[model samples]
Target: MNCPCCSGKSYEECCKPFHTKTKFPQTAEELMRSRFSAFAIPNGEYLMDTTFPAKRKLHNKKDLQEWGEMNDWTKLEIIKTSGKNLVEFKAHYNDENGTTQIHHEISLFEKLNNRWYYVSGKFLD
Candidate 1:
């Protein structure tokens, strides 16, 4: 499938490592790309696994599956990324109803076990 990040690359080439292995993203843009892949592929396990414990929402597999089934993510664009190990961006996608939505957030990340995990996000209007 075409990359949700609009990088003109396949999802496997773009974000599979962040979902499967010990590959850690060196930049916030990379992390955002992987997160977009997680949404597109319905890899809820990977999403929850990569999320920081403090920010984790208690979701059952069914719930995650339902979420995955409900939305079709179209694109992800990095607005900006900064800080020592933190970055934020605006992600865009369409819902099941085909209404486009934009998730603008300043996301936090923490490096652990030589990997980067999503910590938290503050939504912006």
Candidate 2:
């Protein structure tokens, strides 16, 4: 299947490795894409595992699953990737109420122990 991150690559080639721990994303945007794939695939465990430790507390599996279910993610657009740590993106999806909307945000990332962590995202209007 095609990658949900809209990378124009197969799931196995693009995001599955990240999801399954075979390989980790090398950049903030790559991480963001894998996370987007996680949401679209509803892989709550992967989402939880990838989130920064401090932020993971706010993202329980149940809640992530519920949110993923509520938002049927369709496409992902990387608006901009700045430096090696910040990525801005728009995720197009249909909400639980079936309203199509765009989730626009600028996300912060940091590297610790040579691995990238998702710090936070600032929602955009």
Candidate 3:
């Protein structure tokens, strides 16, 4: 199947590796794209695992599951990036009530041991 992130690649070729931990995202933008893919597939494990350790506690599994299951993801657009540690993107999806929404976010990241972790994100729209 085509990648839900609209990366012009198949899910298996583009996002599955990251979801399975077979390959790690090499850049913040890559991580952000993979996370968007995770949301589509509703893989809460990859969502939580990629989160920064300090902020991981704020993300409850139940809440993640609820959010994951409620959204029907449609598209992902990367707006910009700052070096390799920050990214801004928009994730378009439909809610359970069939309302279209844009998750406009600017996200921060940190690299430890050459692995990037999602630190935080602020939604602007």
For all predicted structures, in order, the TM-scores are 0.82, 0.96, 0.96
lDDT of each candidate versus the true structure: 0.74, 0.92, 0.89
Residue 81, model 1: lDDT of 79
Tens-place lDDT digits, model 3, residues 1-125: 99888899999999899988899999898889998988888888888888898898889766776788899999999999988787999999999999999999999999888888999989895
Candidate 3 clash figure, as a count: 0
In candidate 3, position 56 carries an lDDT of 88
Candidate 2 wrongly placed segments (more than 4 Å): none
* Tens-digit per-residue lDDT, 1-125, candidate 2: 99999999999899999999999989998999999999999898888888898888777888887788779899999999999999999999999889999999999998888778888999999
lDDT of prediction 3: 0.89
Between candidates 1 and 2, which one is better according to lDDT?
A: 2
Candidate 1 residue pairs that clash: none
- The TM-score obtained by model 1 is 0.82
Candidate 2: clashing pairs of residues: none
- Score residue 95 of candidate 1 by CA lDDT: 83
Cα shift from native, residue 34, model 3 (Å):
0.6
